[model samples]
Target: MTHSQKHIIGLVFYPGMTSLDIVGPQQVFSALPGVQIHRIWKTLDPIKTDDGMIVLPDTTFENCPSLDVVCIGGGLKQQAIVDDPEVLEFFQKQGKTAKFITSVCGGSEFLAKAGLLEGYRAATHWAMRQQLMSHLGVEVGTERVVVDRNRITGGGVTAGIDFGLTIASILYGEDTAKIIQLLLEYNPAPPFDAGSPEKAGSELVNKAMLFIQEMSDLELASSVA
Candidate 1:
């Protein structure tokens, strides 16, 4: 397909993925004209989200067409994916030809596991940033969205919107991204000032860190077993 007609975006969907990480970006890209979004998985079966939502995959890894961009979203099952050779292979193969390889939240963990994030600066959930650096040996950035060459990663769950808009600007233009942002009514006025660890204060940050620690322990166990 010609450059003008090519706007294929493949989003990897797997069991236990954070729905918002995928859906947030999905909505933004879906709003753009001529952008074809594909929900890809190992099979066309329905995959359950972390919140117990059922998401049906539209394309299987074996049958997926060439994509301009490939994205994966973070969730609790990242360790499972990291240990799955088939999943890593799929990402490794796609990263070879995809114009852009990106992830949101802990999804960058999968990319690092697949050896796709090596030598590229990436971003992930703040809680998992240390683990990402310690385990993957990748340069981690604390930004909402990080772009190193064609590897783009977004921090945390909500950062997916920012990541999507950034990609939108790259593919379409800043004007198109602004139009999509307006259509989504993407203005933010969070009621609480607890979005980040710095703003959340020590008590809340400690609680969140405990949960992250537990998850990291489980991930470590799973990875070695």
Candidate 2:
């Protein structure tokens, strides 16, 4: 990266995406120097997240500038995004030259669908990890963030923070990443130690699995309707 060139990042936004998946990384990237962030979509319209929060896109797929990093955040409507030809083509185009191709959660599915993850190892939400390995032939990872060469991926939702910091450290050095971490007060002390399936136990994990399946079914039905 030349000092004259700005570090540009394109964060894909689409309906039904998880807000934190993009926002967390955005917050971390925003604190860095000489970086430009673009919220990109097929259109410049307002996008509604899975949780009903509305976000506006600043750039469209056709008009987005070349990016240093191309990232997508995932959620329940992943199939829809993956099935969209335009989205897949856009990702394919960006992946050709983007220094880093990345995603959080099920967003990696989009890259997989675009044929960008063909030879890379990746990390995604636990819910989608099996499918990526089985269906897409990706070397799915179990870590919070997985970096295979230029493909930097994050685990489900909250791992975006760790993912961002990891990318930051790689781009700007550990000292700079530490400075940004301190500025953001990036400390984690959750009230419960139930962040993972193993810790949450079978009961909670089963319930969560059931709920996620039900939601997926409903969303699939709704999309068709």
Steric clashes per prediction: 0, 0
Which tens-of-lDDT digit does each residue in 1-225 have in candidate 2? 223446899999999999999999999999888899999999998999999999999999999998999999898876677789999999999999999999998899999999999899999998888899999899999899999999999999999999999988888878878888898898999999999776899999889999999999999888889
**lDDT tens readout by residue for model 1, 1-225:** 113655899999898889999899999988878888999999999998877899999999999888889999988776667669888888889888999999999999889999998899999998888888998899999899999999999999999999999999998888889988999999999999999877899999999889877976885786589
Candidate 1 lDDT trough over 10 residues, lowest sum: 1-10
How many pairs of residues in model 1 come into backbone collision? 0
Residue 186 in candidate 2, Cα distance off native in Å: 1.5
Q: What is the TM-score of each predicted model, taking all chains together? A: 0.92, 0.95
Question: Which prediction has the highest lDDT against the true structure?
Answer: 2
